[model samples]
Target: MTVSFGDAGVVDVLDDEDKSDEAKEEVDSRDEEKTEKGVLESELSGEPYIFDYDSFRVEWKVVSHWEGACNVSVSLTNKSDETIHNWNLSFLSEDEIINPYNARITSEGSDGNKWTFKNLEYNQDIRSGESIQFGFQINYGERIDIPFSYSIDSSEKKVSDSDYEISDQIISSWDGGAVGELHIVNNKDTAIEDWTVTVRTDAVFLTVWGGNIKKVSEDTYEFSCPDYCQNIAPGQTAVIGYQLSGHDTSIEILGLKEWGNKDNTISGNSISDNSVSNNTISENSVSNNSVSDNSVSENKPVTYIESDGHQHIFIDSDEYELLEEGIYLLDVYSDSMTGYINYENEDQNDSDNENYNEIKVESVKLEICDVFDETIWEGDILSDDGFETWSAKDTGFVLGANKLIFDVIFSDDTALKEELIIINREASNIKNTFIELTDEDDDNIYDYYEKYFGTDPDKKDTDGDGLEDGVELFLLDTDPTDDDTDDDGIKDGDEDEDGDGLNILKEYELGTSDLSDDCDLDELSDDYEVNVLGTDPTFADTDFDKITDKEEIDLGLDPLNPDSDGDGIIDGDETITREVSKDYNGEAIDKVSVNIGCKGSMENKLFISKASDKSGILHDTAGLIGDFYDIECDADFETADIVFSYDESMLGDTDESDLRLIWYNEETREFVLLEDSVVDTENNTVSYTTTHFSDWGVVDGKAYEEAFDTPNTPGMSGTDNPYMNNDKFKCCDIA
Candidate 1:
């Protein structure tokens, strides 16, 4: 029931099963790739910068000083270095882009209207290496509050980082000799399941965010020492702190002007920087409930570095790397302590002040323990046999033979680490798969091999082939023929993934088919169809057309009657219809054995007709005398050869009683008794006797040998319990 169309276009395979959403989500990525090829290619050139709604993290400030107007302070930078001075500064409010050009300030549309700020302006040229400030004289405008956040989506080339290939998500961190952390926060509403995250530079070394940061969705994840992250509730924030190693690439902020305040334009916003800074500070609070969508928001109250005076801190003697501005130590020398200056507070330049002494040298740690998965390799330790051990640690951390540690010293807070080292070393090798050896028990075959020497290659291979089953399955490819693939014991576990121990003698076999060379795998194998199940191997009727014996018996149809019309193909689908017509030469076949019917006599014995050419042929054999079989013949066939058994032993008949058996009655269209022609016992009464031609001819004193011209022709029927019928053997010459 299959059809194939080579020239047909793609058609839907309509099935009756209702698939769930997961199946639908498995989109054909191939179709998507084909259709999106052009769109992807177009974006490769030009590289126009685009930002989403949540591009920058913004904080807002609004202050009162110049009467009803507000004073504002802002910090802006172009993250993109390549796109240079092509950036424009547009001051936007909910109403207008308050500039002469009146450019649409944000990434949205504006209604055609005539309203904008004109009071505030800066005519000075701003370039790659300069940053300047301007004043705004505020007047009638008030209440038209500006959105809090501000950002510059710059066009920059990203660099790719060269790191090891990671199969699963892991949480770890690397510090470029800085005092800040590389934190990772999970933001999905639902606890992420089976998710992996990797954050590293795409290409160029992002001085701001460097090294590899990965996290797997485990119950607990660690990035640094004792450095696991906590769940941050909604509206919360997390930071990946790093020293902002001096980044000064001519970034310009064309202009800075306020577009909103209550009224429309900043007609008169001329205020001194000194005055605005003071006024803005007075109205600011650091502990405000956090919310999204707003602009510049304050974190800590406008705090300043203690005005005691700047200390000359020699961070990197060779490289002028600006240690990120979180906090700083006076010296990175080992053992330097930190303290506040009380007596030295009055002398801003007191060189003798002991309060200026603070030192911390950064180092990595290699801690090992099995207390939990987080504490396993949070730092630098190799994973081996489930035991967290060994390390090259990092280069910054000293490579001692025993233990490795991180160097962290803090004054304001306890370092966020239980283990820290201040030096560098090398990376450790993670040995994932191994082999072991055992001895034979000398008794069991499995024990001698699988148990005793399975793990240990030396005990099993006798010759040093360097291969083992467990190792091959876990690490090496399952193809056991080659000792090493590409000369390595570890294989790319794709092919032969099971390592099912396939050998030259007993190779792994197909999951479904029988072990027969000549068989159709799609249908039942020839062995199972014919030899094993005793079914017709040549049958195409899976549902078994009424011709096959099973189906005929089910329908109560006469199977032995091949042509129920006396034609061949016993009710077979192989009709005379051009597809499968078969002709069974006028001879009917009776596959007979013993006929034990529900009648008075077990007289149905194997009887060959004296008019065999008239009785056709029966394909029964020697051992079949003890069983019964459904004989098949064509409705067209009027002559059938049959052999039925009459048990003289069961009837207790001594001198075989004259017997005869009747099969299907052509006249009645149903079965009628035919006295068996043979009997060796005296207990049964039969007319068609087997002893002599005279005995058989005297059936019922009618002499059936001459009764109906003898069985000259064949007959179509199921059972072969033979005897003499009064029908005069119509098959001999029905006309």
Candidate 2:
């Protein structure tokens, strides 16, 4: 309908219909439409409908009304409460049709509140005193979800009463590629379901092919519109086209759950797999569901920064799921929020972190307040023109988030709060999974597992010793993955036993001190590591029970001790055993002790001097004893010699008063007194000297061999061999 307004800016509410003066004669000629007579007391005595044009607000108080064939008419109640002034007539558009409209009606009131309608719905009779009251109404451009209530009286009306609303649009979503039709409700409240519908959405590439939304059961639904269905009579809402794709960035989530598969389609009849989703772990991220889904992920956008006028940015990691903790680099985005924030690093040594053992992150510099344990290691912060890092001395470091307030100088002295998350790795957990195990051709661990288990693990045999995979993995404190388990920049496999890597014999540091392997990294191969390196394999150093890497090279000293010196001499100058066993009550029992004799040495001299042993210098007080018999003669004496032989039966003396035998327990490194036993003879030397023995004396290298039966003893044996009876030379020939 084309709306045309008069000079008064008031448009005829009838839309395109027309009227004329000769229209009166035209109405009279139409006598087929009857009318009632007799001084028709037609009334219209009420205020006009008023509204604030500026704000579009209205106020009203009910006054009077009249009933029509197809609509209701009312007269507004004026404030005076005397007469029915303003009037209006309302009707539903439910009967709107594409066919022609025939409207003819008239309202004549004396209070200048007169409305003449031509071709509008006409009335049949109006007798005197049977006043017809009507009110005016203005239709705003926009449709509001307004509350409406009305009652009907006994009358023959064409319109039916029903609770319905007027809307120009409808929305819905579908699973399958199912297409639905539209349903239209007629003036009689009868639905006509038929015509097809198409729907679309502004979201990228998203579309629903159906239009009709039907209410089936109390909750369930069956949406189908065909020629037999109630649809598209007139004024029925229908969808044209709809689609939805989505933005790759800015999670335009479409799933019903807060987090789940976005693209999932379940068939109406399918019961085998209705839910299409998968959950992992017990963190409640994803859930196990029917198999039917689709999705895509990518990194989050990066925000750049202007730290010291240098444009740096945080790289996007939105797409990748962050599980474990580590450092990362974020790229820069030109337009980003971080461009104003400040960050920094405070490393004192300023060593080229390119060789950083821990994970790396973007370094920067900024001024911030901190509480430090000054007595401990204090990290020096090194800053350049562009960047710096927040350095953490050997102590603990914490990075608080926006909870910590900071005054940024670069972006003015603004007190800005932001999330600060810098994490430094603690070396206490660093361990060498590799160790020197037994190997044939040195395939690391192949020979070990091959010989016993018939299978080999990926092992790193740091030492060339002939052991298998776990020999070093469990014992040597080596890394299985790296050939040079220590990562001291030395190959564990190629490390020389005498070199810095293998030889704890000369190594100094053995603690998790800034210069030590914090975790006592290795626990394998404590043998050679102790002996060879002179390291305390059990304890890292004397007094310091924690082992270190340097001493791990030694096979003797304990690799895990920080104190090789028991007397508080931690520098290894005087390493003493320090082990105190604690009782169940946590009290210290005098930590038990065991003496292990010095075993292997490059020097072939296995035994030290008797004097040195008796001195009680060796640990656990284990040493040799002094005995002239052990020095000059064999135990089971049978050899004929110039020196006297011993026989308890032929004893010349029985007590200390007469003089007797003296012997020393070599193993105990102490002298033992003999009983009052008799001696056959007192012994000396074949050829005695004043101060010392000959260059080729028994002490030089030779020791008396085991005893045997005598063949001949010059003057004693009666054997016949003449050479065996020669004893006169040294005594007579010398004269």
Candidate 3:
């Protein structure tokens, strides 16, 4: 049974088992997408940002610098295992910087030196391992200096010298030149400040971008990080490429050096650089010195290079010129057609048919939109597949004679104009009656007067009883053909068979059944089950115990479970007593009653329900140790409640708060606790509420001895002692 309350107090119940299961499964599957959408919305709503513990990497580059201004770009990458919907970057610097205000980036901060950058509506979401880049210009007095530390959200990142790892390998080789990437990694806990790396290689006239380069020695060349990116944070990588000429086919990094920590100067170098000068020379002499090496290789290795601080494949000038762009159609189709049911054979000229609409061939021709919808090209479509495809320029319809003009662009950036003509032979008025055909289940068959009752897609109400077939089959679990599913005197639509005080439609909407009298089988009618006991009508035993529901109540036990005392003993076998107290509140309190009784014994476990209400049984488990029990009464607007009590002496300090009333689930073979356990420390009792009956028990305490005997004459320690704890032992008579 399922119950739901929608807007305008619209309540509904659905009772079909299979349909309920499918609905639950669907909801569970969509939970993740719903959660993601919620998080995305929260981020878009300008929620406060928190520090992320995941990894982040960024590359910064200085494009150009003049007397007092410099242009810089930063490529921020998310290296973590999550998608960042909204992102921010903050840093401290002395230079006056301007974060370019555009449709995709924004900036904020009061002090010019302290700046915070945010993503605009266009490019905010960044997936893992993807990057978002933005650029800005800064004007400083003297030499431009980059910020020391950088932060994303509220998390800070830094770098040091030990964090610097270097790699320089040959990508491709030719007779006298080679091109490769120079990759520098920051692996420390902080950011590197004002850093410089020197590489010793035998490459003459080596040109690398994203950094400034100068010769340091006869065989050594030094590279400085871009002015805007001198501070390299931890985990961030800086990559530069070398277009080498008159050098060896292979590249090597013999030694290196780093200096000038920006954040903490006292920390100095964290690790030794990979490049060191062997034949040292002054900065002035480096311009005049050159290393001599000449080698060539045939095998070409492809590698990556950082162009303007962004990722790109390394390509020489000649190869770059060979790259060309062309125009291609992505998709084309007629949006006016309903499904694929067009063109009739007999009524080809019948324009009077209401189902058929008229269309002109020339008006149906589609226009070709350029890539990215840019105006950079005018192209003619030479040919296309004769069908309405996702990428075709027009829907291929034989609608009389027609001609289309196309302007196309080739790989050489040259445009051409051409004409295309189409001819049609079959000419007639077409009736589109099939447009009303439907295959809602995607089973490839029309449902109107063609499919079976359950499979009919066009008719949801097959029997037309004001109830949809889906509602009857899946939700109500009733007969779609017969108005009265139970074959009772009243129709199913008009009868509340379950007598739960709700009609069948209401029960269907609330996911409750209206087909059985005692849906829970707790000796309670469906109406009383919900209104009086507040229990589930579809559940035989609300607590899922092994004992028959009504038997628990007749045996002076809790019908909601198999165990009542919670001492590992079923409620039917446990002895119970009652004491009336006026402190309890509710209307149903006057109807509450307790009865204890004795019955047949099983393995020395006494069945106490057979005794009268006024009788008592006395027995000892371990010579002097004994157990006591009692019951309290209460009520609510919906349910009648009872709190069973056991003294703490025999229960081994089991407090009322920790007591959990549980019953054995026969189907799953596991103990499941009732969700309505209410502890009353004031009365030293634990109570459970249910609309039905089942043998119940408390599982947390092992105070009560089992019915099995020990090695004595009676054979067991617990079996020898059998007695009832209360005087009022009788068969509970419940109407």
Per-candidate TM equals 0.18, 0.14, 0.20
**Cand. 2 TM to true fold:** 0.14
Q: In TM-score terms, which candidate is top? A: 3
Q: Candidate 3, which segments miss by more than 4 Å at Cα? A: 1-54, 102-112, 154-735
lDDT of 2 by residue, 1-735 (tens): 222212221212222234453653343344324332111113221222222111111122123333311122232112221211112221122111121112222332222222232211111112222222222332222221111111111111112224122222323333211122222234334332222222232122211122212222222222222111113334444332222222111111111100001212222211112211210011111223211111101111112221232212221333212222211222221111122223433321246644433323333333211111011112232223233223221222221100111222222111111222222122121111121244554554434233322224433333333333443343333333334444456554443443334332123223211112222334433444445544444443423433344432343554345443345644344422221111112211111111112212111221112223333222111111111321221112222121212223322222212322223344443322222323223432122111111111111010110001234433435555322334310111110
Give the winner by TM-score: 1 or 2.
1
How high is the CA lDDT of each candidate model? 0.26, 0.25, 0.41
Q: What is candidate 1's lDDT per residue for 283-345, written digit by digit as tens?
A: 122222332222223221121122222322212322112333212222222211111211222
Candidate 1: C-alpha RMSD after superposition: 34.2
Q: Return the lDDT, model 2, position 708.
A: 12
As for TM-score, the candidate ahead, 1 or 3, is 3
- Best candidate, lDDT: 3
Question: Candidate 2: misplaced stretches above 4 Å?
Answer: 1-479, 482-609, 612-660, 663-735
Ranked candidates (TM-score, high to low): 3, 1, 2
